[model samples]
Target: MQIQDLPYSDPGVPDARSGPHLLWWLWRNQLGGQLRSLAWGLLHFVSVSALPFCVGLAIQAVVEESGTDLALTGALMLLCGIGIAVGDTFLHRAAVTNWITAAARVQQLLARKAAHLGSALTRRVAAGEVVAVSTGDVEKIGWFVEALSRFTAAAVTVVVACVGLLVYQPALGVVVAVGLPVVALAALPLLPRATRRADLQREKAGRATELASDTVAGLRVLRGIGGEDLFLDRYRRASQEVRHAAVRSARMWSLISAIQVLLPGLLLIAVVWHGIHLARHGRITVGELVTVYSAVMILSYPLRHFEEIAMAYSFSRPSAKRAARVLSLERPTDAGGSREAGVPRGDLYDPATGLLAAEGLLTAVVCGDPDAAGRLAERLGGHPAEPGVSVLLGGVPLDDLPLDSARTAVLVQDKDPVLLSGTLRELLDVPASGAVSAEDALAAAQCEDVLEALVQGSLEAADPMDARITERGRSLSGGQRQRLALARSLVTDPGVLVLDEPTSAVDSHTEARIADGLRRLRTGRTTVVFTSSPLLLDRADRVALVHEGEVLAVGVHRELVATDPRYRAVVTRETEEDPAPAGADRNLTGQGALLGASDKLAEIEESA
Candidate 1:
């Protein structure tokens, strides 16, 4: 099936079955051409089963009477051997095709699930769990899928061989039939314990993976604070724990492997002893006894596949459960299926908190805790607001409207927004509508150097704005990335733009330019800036100093700083020697000079 045709929605819940149900589910999807491979596999298996029976028939024919028939029997045996060789070739080819196709389908499902869950997929499941499922889990699932048809044909061949033996000589057939089952069922009792151990191993591995990924991501910060050794010690301990878990899993599997070997060997011994006793009793000839022994020896190979299939399922079950959990995360809404022309009107209301940002106004939310401000911003833009926060746009509940409509009307620009890799121009081409021009956005962001660098690097050759950017825009400085993210948000031109620390990274001069540019760019739209920066706060039409999750004071930046000491400290980093200046009156011209004072003070203290 085409990827587009595959259901992106959740499949409700998965069934925990070990047999044909899962095999059929895989067959029906035909994702990655599984059905075609499945057909070829059946043909391969059928031809394989013909080899043993043909050999037995040749033996029976040669034993039956004349030297005249010997040549014909030898010719027939040669043809059968050639057929088996050809069948084995086709079987290996078809089996590999089945294996790859099954792996590919599971991979596609995993990718689709990741897309559906979006951000929540990582939040709900550890990064390591995702990695494990994609790599190890996919292979185990594929192994089980390909093993099923071979297992089926092997099982049928065994049964038919036993029946043929019964017709040839009932005494040998009885022993063969009963002994094979004992070998197959011996591993069943240990499955539960083996599965539990495997599950523990997988869990430990995921935890270790998560720790390793997180440590790498924060390696720079850890080194800066001299905490690298501490984290390394912790990781070493985690690695030992994973090692211990794996040892336990290996011990259990080793025991299962022993059973697989021991039981099959005992069954072969039992069949040989019974065939000899029957020969002594004059019920079977020497040639018939040799044929019986050969058939029992061949049975051991297929019997091992049974044990392997069990092991594969034990490993894959937890992985499937993890994949299912990831798929279960709720998707972002766009559910209603309607598009709006122009933009939304009036103030956006968050009913849950009874907060309102009036129409065509500059609203500022000041929360001492940065997280609270972030939650408020998400609520304002119809994001996953907390239980009590319900955002409304134009007197309509934001949640009630279709997801696309709410998102288009309100845009939330977080402090540390992600910058995708691409040319400076391509990075800003968000929402893919070309609503904001490259020159205009760069001017508004005061990023003249960034644009110039992009051009000089030949990024602008194909399309002045279309340079190739690396993943996460790691090539750019932190401040540049931040500004580029802000510029991209500004270009979207939403009716309501909520920015959390939009100017935190840029210099005072650039911050001031951006603040003024923002006021001009969003002249008629309802804009809310969440920050404590004096430059951004001073530019706001009004500022609300939020204390203890409530609005304590609301006014211009100057009014709040003059009257409220807490607001003054928050915006200007005031101290006893020199109180912070009030609002826009604060001197921001010497952008680098302000930070230099703090640096000098630290240096003097170090000398002392």
Candidate 2:
């Protein structure tokens, strides 16, 4: 594919079996570009090598005092020079094209994998490693791929030059031919040591990168806890380790480079020494000696390709391995049934926990363990952690449904939902079935305070929807960000909305208003909220107490509090309490309103 056609329209499936295999796959895919680059490289090197031969011929013509031969040789020299200039320029162009296109293809493949796996990608691979692969690692892989053609052409040039030298002068040719292979093979023993050092350096660098990413991500928390210096010290140590490893790796490579230069220099001296001996013996003439010397010098340039190709492979092998590991990750597939056949939509049930969220009701689940709650929430949304486990919707296995269909059918908003950086309108811009408008969703989410906050900050022109939100809504207050996420979820209006701690960051008053608004907005829809807030629990049509791993009690909030001591302790955070009187459920429903009115009056009295 052309470089411009990049980010391939499909980014076709990758062969992620192994690192070497991935590199081979990439090479095969870009054979056209590689061949073009190889052809241009051959032309460039051949023309460069021919320059020495032309000079030798000119010297012979001049020595013989043949005017016609001198003219023809001069003309040949000019043509070789022109060929060198043109070939070198285009060779560079083709090689660069191959490099960029190969990198682009790998980048596209990575991006596609990221999108496919979503949050699961980070779970399988470190965020920093993913970043490294897509950026620096991509370039390294492309470098190896692009260098392949040039290396091939260089090898070919060396072989052809050796053959030409043998034909031109047998004595000097034998010396060069024998010495060239020795020079090339001499460095092979050092490569394994260098490669091992390179791998060590890469490992250290990846850890350092991961440490930096994690530290940055938790900078706010570290500052809050007064642990910034501790983290800084840790990162400093990691950075030092990375630097030490890099220096060590560099030392090995430097030794290899030294060997590369030293061995070639020794070969060059041997060839020159032999050529002089042959000349002294009258076995070769001055023109032939000059030609043999020039050919050996030209051969040195191609010999360096061996070292470069080795270094490239050493660096790129690990990078390709990391990239392949990420690309090999596959989304969880259901072995139960065909998703294309479609499944019914109704009540959401997790057989693992025996938690049933009846259709068209706002079911609240109270769990003592937050982690269990989160896992249960994910399970209810068809993303069970265990294989062969499934969440059923309308008596049909949710996992059996197509990914898009499952997502559309059940929307799960985790406790810590992410808000992408964009304008408020852009943030709310999501694929919806049009059941609710932006204004309605905002109102349902009780986001008037969020809008007012944006307006008061003058973050946008009169319309709060146009206000820009910083990354993950860092500029917004915790409560405001939570409400904005709730509004965004409400807009989708999925059949079953699973919310985990939707109002954990909000005040009781705001949480109360949100609970009421949510119940009203999702009156006829299935909404499963995983929370322990009394305000939200009071409003739930049916409340289930999840103790250990199974549903222990299923009833209204008042009934569960009165009957189950474990449920009461989880919800109220107290072990001892008076049992509610008869008709307490009826009174509690009224108390929800009375509490709201009392809070408002207190606010007004304080203001007055």
Candidate 3:
């Protein structure tokens, strides 16, 4: 495959069995690229191998004072040089194509698996592992694929050179052939130890990576609880462990490298000594001795491939295994006999919570615990809470529909939505229903200030829409990020939008305007907002009060505050130290844990 065709149109289904098998599968799939690389490598090695013989001919010609023979030998040498240049260039091109195409295929496969498994994939796999697999493991796998073909060509060159030596002079060929294999095979004995050390280093690095992500994710909470020093010390220790493990791995590899050099040097010494002795005794000509010695020197370059291919396989085997493990993960789907595809619009009904979000109405869910509200929001979007319990849309379980279909019908804007780095236009360009425009969504979400801030921060931006947001919207404040994410959801304009604490980060004035805009924009569509902020709840068409995972009361926000003390306590966030009036200002208590990632740190640790 060409470099431009790096990512295959389809990466195809992976073997997903064992790691070695996965690597083999990749090899079989990219055989064409391998063949091309091998062909070029053969041309390069064979042409280069002819140089020693040409040099021997020139030496004989000069010694005999045959100018004609010397000139012909010089011409042959020039042709060999040209062959070397062309063959090496194309060989490198083909080999790199193989490597890059292989890496791209693996990355595409991982991305596809992530899309299919969604949040469940994160729950089952470590974030650090995913990050590692996509970056480091991918390079290792590709290197192995590229190395295999080059190694094959090198092996062929060695065998061909040895055969030529035997045909020309059997005595020297026998001595050289015997020593060559010994040199190439010398590094095998130490590889297992080296591989073990490398594996230990990877484990340490992954631990440090996971620790770093967790610390950064909860840095706000860590500082709030005055635990920065504790985490700092913990990370420092993890960093040290990684450093020590890397040093050990390097030492083992260095020893292996030393063996590669030592064995080759010993063989070269033996070949030169034997060749000089033969020339002295008149058993071989001086020119023949020169050819034999030069051939042995040339063989050293290819011999390194043997040691390198071995090391590549050792490192990549484990990486392939990890990739296979992730690809094999299948999210549990009910496949509840195909639901109606035509039923795009429907009310979402959860039997477990007795929460009936009627069609074409703005329903609000108020939960006493922020965690419970987050879980309920996930459940509504077909996330598994308890197996076999599902929320239904228009009498059909959300799980019954295809995963993509369910996702389209009921879009759940979790408490902490992500704002990907891009221009505002690209962020809003989603797989939407096309009913809502970006402008309308931005207005509804009260993101005018966000647009102005983005424009001010970006120097290259010609318009607010042209401004670039940083990764995960780190350049924006919490409120700005939240508003931008909400506007993105609005652009998609899903059938039944379930928002968990959508307006929790904004002030009461912005919240009121957002509430008004939301009600106006989504006049005839179903919307569910899970929040404790009274500003949002009061504007809801109806409110369902959830207590201890069940809907305890269903009424207007005013009536619930008048009759139910539990609803009042949760919604008002009332406390003995700081009790507030009903209309007092407070943002929605958004307890989003890095898209529900922070809430299950223990779960992530256990799974890892």
Candidate 4:
């Protein structure tokens, strides 16, 4: 709550009912800081507003030949100067503290939501949208929060000055006071237009950000099909649209800025002209005329705060709405959860699929459909594809267990697992059971070559463990990435590990080695590998063949291969029994090679 006691232990649940409500909640929560800022800001403005009065008194004292009054007026001016400096300095400090704390609070709330939702956050929201909210939108919300107090201080001082003027001098005060309010509220009509334009720009910018994020995430696949240029073109057009919207928004804001300047200048002219008329008509003295002129000039400064406050609100309202919307999202698995964890070691059962992965066994599920396999993998990890249905462990629904509990109980590595950007050591530095060391897991995953590849790719890497992996491991090949992901999963040493197509990208030689190492490393643990690779199938403790959504067969690989045609059909394409002779697969890309060069070279030469 205080400046030094920053980064609240708990940033309290946000009032995400709406954007305006969230802003109000933040204001009320940060009341202490806001009040401090307002007090200092009020002092600063009051001192500034006092300067013209002291100047007018000095003029009047000089006109009346009063030396004592003049001296006292000069002393008061010095005191006001001191007040101005001290108040201004502390006002800025408080505002900045409030700004930073407000931003930090929002960040903490967002991070908590992300952790609570886990991977489901991305399933519900776009990665780019979340990025925008956490980065750009946070600053906007904080700006509006800090600006509120300053604007209030400025408004209060202006009103006090107007009342003082009305009592001291009627004719000139009536003209100046009425005109100032009109000038302050002059930009109201244009605000809705400016807000609309700004919202359009932000919306387009968010879309452009989403496009760029998606393009970068899939840059590998895009390059594979030679479609990177096409995506690049799309992103370029989206960026252009954002640029145009920004220009339009800027144009509207510029018009508002012009009005703020132009209207005040016009007010100054009218006040000066009317005051000279009053002085010439013998209604006011020269000193009074000078005082009125000085007051009008001093008061115009605070009017700008009104325009600034409007601009800040216009920009941040949408940002708060976005933050509120993201925070409002709830995970489908959030309600049926509990603190009491289920048994970690048990026979995992998916009632939907009628397949069971018993404890202390390596089970292979040969599902002909990859989509079905992917769904099964998600279910095994408590992320059921369908609503109201969950995989069970030890007669307890996986969804009913606490998030961390379910995670420790079952680890499901997606078929195409991603390696986040970090050092090689960090990639494997997971919350683990400590049963398997990183080095041992790497060996078990046959990642020696992958480690060497990382070391070779970096010029400054003295150790493979220190080598940095690029974002999503784009710098590594598909097989190397799979091996690294496998090693990371192995290091966790969970009670049950589900791997979907763990070695689909690797060759038979590597696949065989990985399968042996996998079985050796997971000797007594529950491991379910969804694979159709014959090399992996032959080593499993049991194989279940799933055809059309039903478990059709369950037996040893050799028995199933000999007795069940469905199981054999699924794994047959991957069976590499006979070896090809040398040069058998060499490309016959040229004319002579296609005609069997050694046998047809002489005949082709004679024909030519």
CA lDDT scores, all candidates in order: 0.70, 0.85, 0.84, 0.86
Ranking by lDDT: 4, 2, 3, 1
Model 2, CA-based lDDT: 0.85
For residues 431-498, write the lDDT of model 4, one tens digit per residue.
99999999989998999898888889999997999999999999998999999999999999999999
Local accuracy of candidate 2 as per-residue lDDT tens digits, 316-414: 999999999999987675443466855367788888779999999999999999998987887787766657468889988876777777878888998
C-alpha RMSD for every candidate: 6.6, 3.4, 8.3, 8.3
TM-score of each model, paired residue for residue: 0.81, 0.92, 0.83, 0.87
Clashes of each: 4, 0, 0, 0
Residue lDDT tens for model 3, 130-233: 98999999999999999999999999999999989898778788988888888888888888988888888888888888888888876777888999899999
User: Once superposed on the true structure, which residue ranges of model 3 sit more than 4 Å away at CA?
Assistant: 56-79, 210-240, 276-282, 334-343, 351-354, 385-390, 400-403, 451-468, 545-608
Best by lDDT: 4
Residue 398 of candidate 3: its Cα lDDT? 81
Question: 1 or 2, which is superior by lDDT?
Answer: 2
Candidate 3 pairs with clashing backbones = none
